[model samples]
Target: MARNAEALDLVELLPRYGLENYKPNIEINLFGRLYSAPIAIAPMGMPGMVWPGGEEIFAKASHKARIPFTLSTAAGATIERITELAPDTTWFQLYRMPHNNLEMNFDLVKRAKSTGVHVLILTLDVPARTKRPRELRNQLTIPYKPGLHTLIDVLPHPGWMLALARHGHNSFANYKKYTNKKLSGYELAKFARQRSGGTFSWKEVSQFRDAWPGPLVVKGILHPNDAEKAVSVGVDGVVVSNHGGRQLEGAPATVDVLPAVVNAIGKEATILFDSGIRSGLDVVRVMALGAKAALSGRPFMYGLGALGVQGADHVVNYYTEEISAAMRQIGVHNIQECNNIVIRHENALKF
Candidate 1:
């Protein structure tokens, strides 16, 4: 995750001369619908940990901003709750379970549809859960069994503890349909490793296509060839991501691979970028390369943590403000113009 942050600093934006007269229109189109900006809140699990009502806060903000709000299946908020928060502009990120839980997976998909979510973002990167001893050592994994050490660690931050309590204690609400009992701490972590089961499959594309009636986006793609494969499988979009560098230790930075995937897939699929985006400038940087849109996660979490429900809307507005400022500096109007901007700085020069 630190590397993901470091990679963004290396990407310097080159300013274009003399096009500053025309106001940069930040509007964007995704899967035939128009949005106010080229930014969308990326799907993230357990956001409530960062803020009391993180999921619904983001949903409301995204809805007000007229941008897409993606809900992770593992997000503590259920599909029903997320849609209720942002019925019209909701998207869902799905994690397909292994062979035994295939039916359960479809049932979850059904639940997502019931919420009127239009886009199904199938995350292909989480092949399996990687072992992160830090989370286990702190007892911060699912079910979040707070030991004496955890109590000691969290006692200083009463706000976080209270928010965690109010948000219902890290239970995976979407997964509740499968089993009433909640899995937490080590047991939850163990289940993650066991549930990952296998990698992406071409055969599964047909299954998803047959089941979903909306635009299907395959996320977590880093390689050009995989981008080609995703388009060949008939996905409407491909998100260039590396799971925020949380899953793979030595994977390529998303910024490094965005161009390759976009170049390879071309119009076959809409190329979206994720994993390292931190601001409106970062969003502009990726768009100037080739991505049609950028999805961000951490920045909004930062907002939620700082200002509660209002912070969510504040962040969206803040990103929009930043995007407009960045575009004015770069001299572009609208998202399409950013699609093929010239890279003025070869090695991310400091401006």
Candidate 2:
């Protein structure tokens, strides 16, 4: 029953708790993927539109921060390009395609491995496409449809338009060879919707588990039963997410579900969390609740889109500093110490 307003309330409380006096380290491990900090950049699509060379900039920033960066299947750059740019820091996230294209998608996964991607995350919750009104009003579709409205919207932002002209329109570059046609905006969205696996099921999850050789993580999980089922199917980890509250509006905040999901999986599986995590204190709160690590999607994108590479780096550094400060205030030194902290319920109604 977590509301969007509550998420915003927590976001507003972040800056008050600073990291100046805290001497802390925030390293974490996920299926042998060592991170300097438990913070990771969530996979986001169309980064280039937000900032010129968005994926490359973010990847470099992540490398500098010593954290893992995941590349989206629908990102502007190919997985190979992103892996090449970030090397040891890149992971790949898949938006599952229809059953007929499973082999092609598996080939894409193998290609990703060739580029040294160590982890494969399967995003399973986006069965239906969301209609973002702003995007529609701007006529900003996936492979971008350039209508009078779209051109007018672009005319005002000379910087963005200039970048687009220099780099060409932002499209899913990786899928070009497979699709053999150019798409943008609404066409791209329609194409993806036509090709995406709307009927993706648990059986396919099991199939992916057996087929992929690397550590497999199931993202977009919000239910404890789903977490248990993922463990039963041999998933290496489960990311407790509601797709950043973009998919389902009424879904519980990922923080509220972290404890139950961790408890359900026990010590056999890793429990990661995302959604509504805007600052260091929020990261500590989820860690205290039992998350092995935490990630942020829109925050880093905001930094990148608004300030480019430096902005991306600043966001990562800011969170790392924030988490360290929060830990020291609570008398903890490392992520494991977070477990000793407790949540104080506003009212106690149960035994």
Candidate 3:
């Protein structure tokens, strides 16, 4: 989280004054589709843990706002449901399932293709799960045991409790059907743990590229060589991310490496971005640095946590307005022009 915040804080945009006559355009195109803004809701696991039906709320809002909503494999809503909600804007993110002899992984790919998901993002960052200090401190767990401490935590947030009462517990909505038996909470989490782990090898990614007929992306890329490797393996694009700085404490901030990745393969493959994006100005920063579009997860989650159903749309609108104003302030009239804006980054990673 600190690294992501630094991505925003360490950069300064130098604005030109006389270019204020025209309105800035934030619209962007990704893999042949047009969006109203150069922004997307990054896929997040178990967003319902933040708000009941959080994934659904994001999908609906993304659709209404004409931006993409990438749904995580660990999302609380099913691929079919989120695709139905967004259709034109739905993108599916995948985590390789090494258990069940990889049947579950292929099955997920097949299901996404059948549902007409526009893009398939295979996340490559989580080679292994790492312990999170914040979740540990908060006593938060997958199944959420209600001990006295947890109850004390719950009492202060009556709205959260009320939402939980109405929505029940969040589950791996996609994995439930594959379990072949009714499962909830602990059982479902155990099932997912057994059936899922690890990132994909290049060979595995090539196989997926052959199987899925639409655009394919490999997320969690930080190295220029890895970005070139993803393009070589037939992925349509690469998401330059460090798993939002949630993994590998010593890993470089995504912004620091983004320029190098873009320099290496920006022409051959589409370059998307994630991590540390707290506002639309951050979106402009990455776009100016070379990302084709920016994806954010936490800020919208904050929106949902604070405002409920209205939060998702509010977050989108917030980014939209901020993006426009920031572009104008930087003297850019559109997203492409953002790339040419003058920027100062002392610690940017070089190839």
Candidate 4:
């Protein structure tokens, strides 16, 4: 599914380099809060596994960039800790719990608000706990046990061990109190399987919207009908995504369905895009198609994995520069005008 999204392309036009007496404005007005850029760091679980202090690095860089850094309930740093690190620049991604644990989930939302999270992203995908063969094979579980396979895998990487020593365990700090003790890979997996609020109907989604009075965003949407439904229920935004192709392998590419979703919802709600954004041009493409902003998880993750904390800074600035350059070349002054330069290529071919 990730490959499918990557396979899609946006048509480019001849450079109109001389037409710019203006600067590119990439500012985003997310829920009345102004941000310097329209791109954000997508929440990835165990970002630190890619590099030590992964969440911290992202937090600092995001703060510097004046963009929201989404903290995953399953990854990055805890809400409380991230607030201390970056204050109001963080957004929380919520994975709804079952009705049996409704109060606790509500409390979790309150806790996030208490920590100064103004934006709440409710992900409505992953209907069931599907098997991920790669993770299973590698035994990448909660509290990451040093099984034979993993032990052997990390044996040669003295740097990872050193970083781990400095940063300590990478368990879900927010969920630590809920569980009795540190859970092993299998134990944690079992718990998640049992507790995962895999899929949600309209009623559940509406309930969440009513509860979260702040900027409420529903991520992981593909269908135009779903986008319309989100707006009808007073959602602040809809993120066109397929959980980065992790939820369903055969699902349509997010970019392919973006136009329909935008047409359905119109400007009724902010439309964000993700799932297979690899370059600054991709950001331009999504915006041209009709997205308020675009996020790339793996590209940023890869940056962190390749260059420690510095890689994160590079990712932000690199993307920013790329967007500005593309805007100039395509003769668009700002993100709002990017769509004007897009040549309709329904049968678009990738370069």
Best by TM-score: 3
Query: Model 3, residue 149: what's the lDDT?
Result: 88
The prediction achieving the highest lDDT against the true structure is 3
Candidate number that wins on lDDT, 1 or 3:
3
Cα lDDT, all candidates: 0.79, 0.76, 0.88, 0.78
Per-prediction backbone clash count = 3, 9, 0, 0
- Kindly give the stretch of ten consecutive residues in candidate 1 with the minimal lDDT sum: 342-351
TM-score of model number 1: 0.90
Q: For every model shown, what is its TM-score relative to the native structure?
A: 0.90, 0.88, 0.97, 0.91
Evaluation by lDDT, superior candidate among 3 and 4: 3
lDDT of 3 by residue, 24-45 (tens): 8888889999999988899898
What is the model-wide C-alpha lDDT for candidate 1? 0.79
* Colliding pairs, model 1: 142-184, 142-185, 143-184
What is the Cα-based lDDT of residue 213 in candidate 2? 86
Q: Write down the RMSD of candidate 4 (Cα, Å).
A: 3.0
Q: Give the per-residue lDDT of model 4 (tens digit) for 1-351.
A: 556455445434445566738778888787898888889998777788788788888888888888888888776467888878778688888887674646656777888877788789888886776677777877875545666887787789888778888886554666655676767544654565456656667787788777777898989988888888888888989888888888787777778788888888867999898988877877887888878898779888889877877888899998898888777778888777876664564743221
Candidate RMSDs in order: 3.5, 3.8, 1.3, 3.0
> What lDDT, from 0 to 1, does candidate 3 have?
0.88
- After superposition, candidate 2 runs with Cα above 4 Å error: 1-22, 99-101, 181-190, 197-199, 345-351
